[model samples]
Target: MEELDVNVSSSEAFGIAEKIVLLSFISAVILMAILGNLLVMVAVCRDRQLRKIKTNYFIVSLAFADLLVSVLVMPFGAMELVQDNWIYGEMFCLVRTSLDVLLTTASILHLCCISLDRYYAICCQPLVYRNKMTPLRIALMLGGCWIIPTFISFLPIMQGWNSIGIIDLIQQRQFNKASNSTYCIFMVNKPYAITCSVVAFYIPFLLMVLAYHRIYVTARAHARQIRLLQRAGNPAEPRQGHQEPRQDHQEPRQGHQEPRQGHQEPRQHPPDQHSTHRMKTETKAAKTLCIIMGCFCLCWAPFFVTNIVDPFINYTVPGKLWTAFLWLGYINSGLNPFLYAFLNKAFRRAFLIILCCGDERYRRPSILGQTVPCSTTTINGSTHVLSFFFCQRRGGGPAAPGLAGQRNQRGCAKVPGGVGEGNALFPQSPG
Candidate 1:
């Protein structure tokens, strides 16, 4: 196949306007990705409720990937958009391209892992999610995603066998003879580039799509089973001969003590009529991750294929065209957090907490139960309160009075945590 001979020329006015637009877009994407993902990281870290769930561990990895992509790739594309060439040194060029490859791979794998998490959560009838999604497994999956792809990206640079390698050997030989030439990051052959594409992009993409499709089918099936169980009769309720335990349990200090603070710990409540709604929320989270992964696949697929596979194919995609695809592929970095804000409640609240308070998390008592020491009040037209719980978690139905200190509990700290009947969830204020 003949190489694309694009002249790559435009009028000064068009170029300047294009640069301004691209620069603005890049800036906004960076701003949102950093702020949004940092919020997520903080929420997952500081909130015990969020950490208890396995799915959030995947969210943490996904946010990290988005943040990494913004820092590693977006700015370079912004600079190249203005200068119309790779002005940075050859080493940076390799690093930029490699980071793009590795982080994108990590992002896709994270989404795939999320799909798996949701699948079992909804599908397995007898097993509880906590029993299914153990801490060690989540940690192992995250570790595998990052550690595995790193070598796939970095080895090319270390061995001097990649694009930089090809250019460097040629440029140096020419320099030994004469000093009038240039050094760039262009690769030499079809096999080398194509191999990188297969390792970094195509295989992971195939896995993500298949994994999500399976997750969707499994979740829907589980939801249908749950609906059936409710319609037939509450499978969870015991026979007429038995009685359910009281909320405070077998306590000697019931008169002087507070009620339990969260969803009854030993699977006390099965999702009921609102099961559909819960399913919908879960589905939306899956969809958001799927969209994010799909966007990443589409954006980078063409560029990688054209860069690597095009050399062997009959159609030679222009360098500029491929570069544009590369930039588009990376656009996902900035788009992820905003997408979460729009689609996921937890993420939106998390974003608000970080942006408004300049911190990742604030601890308070639970909001849903009476035992919580803190009470709600309106301050400056915002619903806020100081909570008593030392650590706040985000998900597991409405918090009992013991754990509602989420993003909504931003500034009003005077409210107490734990029940007045007992000691506050946290120790009394120092002051």
Candidate 2:
């Protein structure tokens, strides 16, 4: 009898150690997620350059959504995971589940909105993009990102719409449980699973994929144009036969003018330097955003796939697996801020400035002083310009009479200078 008692105590100690390990890991994740998302929100709010770009508005919204996920959704999830049972009553359980669904769906939708915003800015005409992505329109899209998840999350879960066919099975499990402790079982029927997964994951995934694909194509075309311009500007050799008698006689005059022209022309028409740098920056920003999207998809896809498949398989998926997938999705909330800091120079600077308690060295120089008036209008005290690539003329000069029309008659609307540099998502340079 003493031997049996000793063995039981040893097993209990082992179980307690396991629980401690689980709780510690989960607590760390929760803390990181909360702090990281808070940093993103504060960085965007404080950084002048980040505020100037309209795309960062969507990013701020995304960060806010992730922040809510960390604050509202993660702690309860961690508690339930550590305890291995839902001590909270049925009403609170439903509320927690609803919040879980609502916040995650909103986060995903923000990503889709961001992709669409980029597509419109990069692929459409400047005027068209400006008209389409007005402040009011942006507000509406941001509002929809927050509001559209309710139908799948709170309304259905609260009204008992998710357990339509599984009511009996759920009751049976509750009755047959070995312990009397309550469980927050969020089992769904096939229809609910399909509808929820479709709304929350699949549709937004499709939209994001499509938008990024178009942005990629447009970026590739712009790159090709830059390459062609470089090759034309720098030829292998001068053709002796093509030189006319006028060229031979005027050679000395041209030679005398060459030194002055060479100094001024580079600043005016620096397609090789300015244009190529701008394209490279834009391409890099796009690639970074794509990496973000890929991470989001990777984290959420497993849980959502299982969410849809579990009901069809009669809910045979193990409880541990469900918990693992759910926490994996939660980890994404913490990953975004790290990804931004590592991948984006602007974000990194802003983060450093914030973390260092407003250190001057980490702060980026203000670009507002260099702002040139172009095809942009101020709305609500914020300058909204969609055409980063479009320039007025070389050296910020006004276009000649009928020059705009002639360029419009041809296919080229964007010149090589005058407007801001780089893409809408990032600043012109690291500073």
Candidate 3:
């Protein structure tokens, strides 16, 4: 075995003042992240309405990461602030770095997924998006993100993790045992950090920037079209002389002037409202994903540069500051729900409905209190059974079911009978 660098001393990279500031920042970030992500998870789990689509599923996955960071990273980080040196053993250091790498990777991948989702949705490629972005596919991507890096992280520990073969910790314990004090693992190698940044940060980053740029271009086109249409008409009287050829009018609505009357019957198209909403949603969601990606890059970029570039430059900075910045990137997991609500109508509606579920209407007298969506599954053999629970609107007044929106998992609005309210007999996508 290689001799341990136990006695190798590293210069103190952080002062007490810097440590205090970093601790404060990360502590604030950790607390907010925990609450935000917990709210998202609870709302999704309690309300059946949030799980109807791929986007919400991704949101939940991100929340899971945030919860993990809060549980696993924050406390250790706080303790480390007080004790500048690692009191915890090599094992914990390894685990810490591994989890940090994996979770951050997953979060970045989520942002990328969201950007792709937005692109397809806004670009009118629903079938392609739906076919490609399955839950199983997402699960595999997440698995790959975790398993691959963890394998890489443990590679240099004793030997290549692949070469180490299956660890029979059970049997190993029978021989020479590691100390009980070896609970924390942070002794990660530099290769793992560099590789993590490349795969998890740079790749996803470039992809999101490209996707968002395209989305912005497309959205600008749509905005231009909408403006032209708006300018060409009077809500009261239609404008004249600026008309297009008959081929363009498409189902001239029962109202356009007679010149457009004989226009070849415009092709019957899908619902305009639906298409418009989808386009708007995709554009906004893409932008949000880009912003999230930007945040990730900003947080991780400094640490990566410091850690990687410093070796050659022999440059050193405050380790506490760098560590705090790195953890800050993980905060994106908690911000996802807020981003979704801000950028996507479906998510916003889901959040609103879930919030309203606990009201007096549903709680006391009215139709029902606020209710959020949860995943309920009964797996028997090859098939799966899923059901959603609905909560009535908040105001203790009558809820016109129409106002409740489409019922399939998105709405989760149940009538007096088991029947649902909205016309959508099936969810846009299965859970």
In terms of lDDT, which candidate is strongest?
A: 2
Where does the lowest 10-residue lDDT sum fall in candidate 2?
4-13
Give the TM-scores of the predictions, in the order they appear: 0.62, 0.77, 0.60
Best by TM-score: 2
Ranking by TM-score: 2, 1, 3
Which of candidates 1 and 2 reaches a greater TM-score? Answer: 2
Tens digits of per-residue lDDT, candidate 2, 367-419, equal 56564333333332223232333433432555442243233233343322112
Q: lDDT by residue for model 3 over 1-431, one digit each (tens)? A: 11111211211345788778767877777787787777777766765544655555666776777678777866786675555445766567666755666666666676676666555544433346456666788677556645654544444433533212223421222122232222232322345446645776677778777866676665555445434333322222232344445426655553555454333112111122333443454345345545665666676666666655543432233444555565656566556656644344334444565578755433222225534232122111001111112233333344342322222224332222110111111112222
Question: What's model 3's lDDT at 1?
Answer: 13
Between prediction 2 and prediction 3, which has the larger lDDT?
Answer: 2
Give RMSD (Å) of candidate 3 vs. truth.
13.3
lDDT of each candidate versus the true structure: 0.53, 0.68, 0.48
Please give the distance, in angstroms, between residue 13's alpha carbon in candidate 3 and its true position after superposition: 7.9
* lDDT of each residue in 51-134, candidate 1, tens digit only: 554556777888899888887777776776565545577677777867877887787667667656654543342235456667
Error of 3 at 111 (Å): 1.9
